[model samples]
Target chain A: MPYVNIRITREGATAEQKATLIQGVTQLLADVLNKNPETTVVVIDEVDTDNWGIGGKSVTVRRKQGK
Target chain B: MPYVNIRITREGATAEQKATLIQGVTQLLADVLNKNPETTVVVIDEVDTDNWGIGGKSVTVRRKQGK
Candidate 1:
């Protein structure tokens, strides 16, 4: 059995949207890889922009700079 | 920091393709959300056809049925 775990930052996702997104992604994986929906898990991590950074830049700063 | 983890079933990805996919995904996250590339992690799980199922149906069976 293949176990796929996804932990994504919850940026603009509303509660309903988050649920649907998880469901959609789960369905996509299940459909494409023939994995059991029960075994596939998707996790969301809601973090502050200050806490998340990429390439040595903070998300908040990046957004402000538009880069 | 927001942590995003992805575990995907390796289908047709060559070794180089897999590396590039990881790099691209990491870069995408970094570029979009300003996340540190060092913390972004992507895992790949190569599973047999029988181990993965979606919607209560085996992937291989689904493929056979043209679903």
Candidate 2:
């Protein structure tokens, strides 16, 4: 019952890519930890740049400043 | 990197409870695993019962049936 949440910037990622990501992560955990993929829960959260921060600055601001 | 995610039914948990939960989990990891609370990322997701499932049934349906 390993639960994994993957967070990424809200850039355009196709649904197919998301599906692949879920499968890949599940497989990786299964291979390494021997966790059952059937019970493993995977959630993907796409966060807005304005809401994501780095080094006390929002990603939105950092991108605008070319940092 | 120790990232903890808490998922609960969207049944009106107060801000104080959320704060306590964050602190409690962080402390648990720090005490047991000697993890750094400063770097441990904690995320709480209040999922609607409709979107959460148990025993092959959505929590919404389970609640409706008094399960």
Candidate 3:
């Protein structure tokens, strides 16, 4: 019942990248936590730059300022 | 800081529905956990049926089997 959610900026990540992430994260949990990979669920989310924020500022704005 | 992730099979969920979820979840965390809403991060993932699995089978397969 281990659920892992990975969030990244929407920057054209390929399907293969997502599949690799899923496999790698599952394997990591199995190796470190003794968790069963069969039951472990990994979900990857690609968020829009406008939706991801830092320092109370959206990523889009931060990128525009080159920070 | 509270980070909440809600996952649902991708099925044409409208922008309003997603916004409501973000607001509702943020409010819930504030009310129950006393977490600051400003610090709370809520991400909603609309996953492909092929990517979500249950009982050793993907949601797509499960639906086809009518289980």
Q: What is each candidate's DockQ, to 2 decimals?
A: 0.22, 0.07, 0.16
Query: How many backbone collisions does model 2 have?
Result: 0
Error of 3 at A5 (Å): 0.9
Backbone clashes in candidate 3 total 0
Candidate 2 TM-score over all chains jointly: 0.52
Return the top candidate by lDDT: 3
Candidate closer to the true structure by lDDT (higher is better), 1 or 3: 3
Worst 10 residues of 3 chain B by lDDT: B50-59
Would you list the C-alpha lDDT of every candidate in the order shown?
A: 0.62, 0.76, 0.79
Question: What DockQ number belongs to candidate 1?
Answer: 0.22
The RMSD of every model to the true structure, in order and in angstroms, is: 7.5, 7.5, 6.6
Clashing residue pairs in candidate 1 (N, C-alpha, C atoms within 3 angstroms): A34-B52, A34-B53, A35-B53, A36-B53, A53-B34, A53-B35, A53-B36, A54-B34, A54-B35, A54-B36
**Per-residue C-alpha lDDT of model 3 across residues B28-64, encoded as one tens digit per residue:** 8889989999999999878876556444445566578
Whichever of 1 and 2 has more TM-score, that candidate is 2
What TM-score would every model get versus the actual structure?
A: 0.50, 0.52, 0.57
Give the CA lDDT, 0 to 100, for residue A57 in model 1. 90
Q: Which has the greatest DockQ?
A: 1
Cα displacement (Å) at residue A16, model 3 = 0.8
